[model samples]
Target: MVNVEVIATEELGDRSYLAHDGSVAVAVDPQRDIDRVEALLSALGLTLELVVETHIHNDYVTGGRQLATRTGARYVVNAEDPVAFDRVPVRAGDEIAVGAMTVRVVATPGHTFTHLSYVISDGDPAAAPAVFTGGSLLYGSVGRTDLVDPARTDELTRAQYHSVRHLAESLPGETAVYPTHGFGSFCSAAPTTGGPSGTIADERARNDAVLEPDEDAFVARLVAGLTAYPAYYAHMAPVNLRGPAPVDLSPLPVLDPAELAARIDAGEWVVDLRDRTAYAAQHLTGSVGIGLGPQFATWLGWVIPWDTPLTLIGESAEQVADAQRQLVRIGIDRPRGRATGTIDALADGRPTRSYPTATFDELRTARGEDPVIVDVRRDDEYAVAHIRGALHIPLPELADRLHELPDRRLWVHCQSAYRASIGASLLDRAGFDVVLVADEFPHAQELGLTD
Candidate 1:
């Protein structure tokens, strides 16, 4: 029997796997991590035959075209959309054969008009099937309807409900179901906190949206709970559709401190992905800071321009490589070069300083001091209300308007500590003394800020 090995994308936390039958392999929803996929393919010694994109993903730039180009594999997508790749346009009822395995495409378009789920079956008619449901069907929820035309929210909602029903009724009860996304992803409302793969029967029992028969009600519930899409999504969709120019990662001329300063003064952000303390002491002028911490990949993706070329300032060569890998995970492709002799390069010139941050209690104590409290959470979270006198900057917009912040003590907070930490760190690196509020506010009343 052929074996399928699923690999989660580094940044997406979504499932992208390789299905192989000894001699040939097919990749599903490949992320931008080409090296990792290549390594896996090399280890398996199987020729890559096909790349199947389940839908047009908006969250991160896809690597399907890149993978197909490198491996000479056919790129497959739903026949409805003219996806830019070596073409194998699959439609509902079409079956693609890879060696001894057969993949049947099922049009499942609630997530987007072109979403397709593939059912993989062994060539033997008696063998059961496994479905790669992409974003169309998830463990406990359906893909959000607002991703497409806002006016057709209802129609898309109906489509999703029927899609779930169709999968449930048509696929055998024992068919394995694997989804592309999981919890902590923006794609679905109720994401599975478990692994990348599950079964149709398990999802049918546990997934609330999948179990619901009333299409309109399901749509209403899903739409009501959607978090705001990241600003990157707006740019990534069209870029992916049209295909971006090949990224050039060749080393650029190493800039001296003066040249780096001039670039920073010209409004180019120098992101130092070293440790917080190193960034705190010395960095290029106007460089917003993020470290190679746990949330490094996420904050980098959130704050930096996807198209912008990054001049990485790392403490060591290893850190620079780590930073590069992190950036690539989220599809940030234009890495200009790493600053060698990082400390020595800045020793002859003035090093930029970082900002200071305050704690929740410090915010409370200094409430009367009139410090500007910037809540970096999204507007929807702020609509539920925020600390009194807190300005809503949203982490994604913080880099653009750092000058708007008054030259006073700045305090920042988000739902949990994650975003606030990132914002505070950036502000700190950009020369603002900011404090992160570590307390979790269960209700609006807990926030002691004034209106």
Candidate 2:
């Protein structure tokens, strides 16, 4: 009997499926979390056969090729783009066989020109199929169409409309739907909240994007909610397309304050991989902090100069390993070392500092007190609507453009407290008295921010 297990990476908020038939297993959309997949397979006594991807993702660097390299499995994706490692290029109607199960490719080009969905069937006509609809479809929304060629927006939108229709009509009514992204993901039009896998019947009745039939109207609605792609995508896509180079995982020595100081003096960057709140409480001087939380790998690669060696300050040994792993996933190799005597070092005459945090009500009260509210969310999120007086400086750009922020009391916020805390901590270390709002901010009329 073939059993499908869904593995969710809490780090990237991405879901990948592992299908095992008690002998061989197939993995889809492997993110940076290969250890989970490896552990699952190890428990099942099954070997990996294939690693599949719907398309080249723009959000986080993919681990499909890397997993394949480590496991001797063949990497699979659309035939349009060339990929590294042993791969089997598939297109619409192509079938991939794994024991008694079969995965049929269905081209759904909107999120990306070469996006494809896989329809998994057990070979029995009586049993309904299960579709792996990567970024093409989600629980509450559809994938954003702006990431691809702007010239092909119309064409891609039309293609996406037909693709959705195809899934609705072509697949059996009871067919199960599985998507790669969910809520908190910036790839889709709206936040997606639900299980990693759902039924087409549920999505047909609940997903607003799927309810609309008029092609042009749907296209307009889809475009209206697109958030600006992270600055990392411009560089990540090419590296992923060319395939991430292999990384050496040797552990580095922990550097003392004097050693870290010298590295910083020579222009290297110190990355504090703790949570935003923890980092905000205290950090080393001149350190550019990027929390090792979800999106840690993506944001770290984006904000820091890739060529510079990174000195890490992790909360623990495990955190240090996690930080190192994340860096290698993006093909970043220069890990100078970990910070020795972490907190003790910061307290040793190195000008340690902390940032303040404010509750939602506190921020509202201070809005009229002449404080600058900086919204650190992406540009598109700010454009859709934001606090009237807030300035937009995405978290990825905050470290470099610290000068743009006025030298006064600053209040910062993001969709949640995580990003705001990180920004606040960075600014505080740079000698600014910053306050992080711990709640979601005003989004036009919906949020009650009149000023």
lDDT of 1 at 121: 81
Clash count of each predicted structure: 9, 1
The parts of candidate 2 lying over 4 Å away from their true place are 84-86, 193-195, 247-250, 329-334, 346-348, 359-369, 379-392, 399-403, 436-450
How accurate locally is residue 63 in candidate 1, as Cα lDDT from 0 to 100?
A: 78
All candidates: CA RMSD (Å): 3.2, 3.2
**Residue 283 local lDDT, model 2:** 74
Best by lDDT: 2
The whole-model lDDT of each prediction reads 0.73, 0.75
lDDT of 1 by residue, 340-361 (tens): 5665465456654554444566
Model 1 TM-score? Answer: 0.88
Residue 147's lDDT in candidate 2: 69
